[model samples]
Target: MSINYPKSIENLIKQFSSLPSVGRKTAERYVFHLLKQKPEQIKLFAKYLHDLPNNFKTCSKCLSLSEENPCSICSDKNRNDKIICIISNFQDLLAIESTKKYNGKYFILGGLINPIENIGPDKLNIKLLVKEINSKLKTLPEIEIILALSPTMEGETTSLYLQKILKNPKIKLSKLAQGLSTGMSLEYVDENTLANALKFRGIIK
Candidate 1:
């Protein structure tokens, strides 16, 4: 009735299983695969994983992960400061950026509003977003807010909450066009489809 694997190997498997979408079987496979690799390589990988959290910081403006305080996109002079694309996560932001059609800046919400999961506006960085908008209004004077969140229920709830908080006539608020079907995530949309959606965004009431 004794397990063949060492205690350390079992512990590593447990740790890997803790990751999102990784089950015990996959974790075991991963551990065995890593065991096959050279100690130096494993050491390097471990070092990188251990240092990642300390190495990267979130941008003050957009909350994107970055080595710098403000990410490259936030500091880019070529990007349009007049418009800000609001996305649920960094993956959504990357999806929009891949289209190469959107020239505006981005505000990453980190996640959507999932009431069932107890995630709400306060849990998100909404206050920082409002502060960013206020700062922009004072400096730029003319800016638009674009909601590029997913078409899911959570996404809609988050968008509505953000719209309510950022409701100012001075800021032109818009949402991505209906091209993106309901219940679909932006990350899965093709580049051309995403580009067209961006090109034809509509004002949100």
Candidate 2:
């Protein structure tokens, strides 16, 4: 049975509940935790959330959200411009970056193709990726494109779709190696596993 929370508490609970993996009980706990915080703490939290829209800009080249247009990674000259690791989101990109093993460029696809969610190739950043690769090939003779997406069904579907669309003599496509647990998202994988996967990425046909 649901307790009759006050209107303000109920509204906050609903907002928290809408977040991924947050159920009603989890949301309720979150709200109560916030309520226990000092007023200044709550105000700081609200300020951060409110200022999020003004805080960052999406990198034009990779679509990663950062304080600058072309994120620090994209701006770094030391990174391998001939290689691009394609990921579903910023979280996964950070996961890969944390490994410190990869020295290549990155492209955030925004989302994977989940037919159940009505997401398809068109909904992702495929067009931009193709355009970027085509443009990069002009300056560079060859480019390596790594499909570093999650291991879930949607991830596989998106990878397969990408395999078909990103065809070019100069583009060599690869993906995370077989050791990753099936259906595991990259964000949750340990740094060692992620680093190994990048080190042993497999060629895609």
Cα lDDT, model 2, residue 34: 96
lDDT of 2 by residue, 29-144 (tens): 99999999999999999999999999999999999999997899999999999999999999999899899999999999999999898987888888898888888988999899
Off by over 4 Å in 1: 2-5
Per-residue error (Å), model 2, residue 56: 1.1
Candidate 1, run of 10 with poorest lDDT = 135-144
Task: Assess every candidate by TM-score.
Answer: 0.92, 0.95
Count residue pairs with overlapping backbones in model 2.
Answer: 0
Model 1 — TM-score against the truth?
Answer: 0.92
Candidate 2 residue 7 C-alpha distance from true site, Å:
2.7
Candidate 1's residue-wise lDDT over 115-151, tens digit each? Answer: 9999978888888898899989998767899999888
- Report every candidate's CA lDDT: 0.90, 0.93
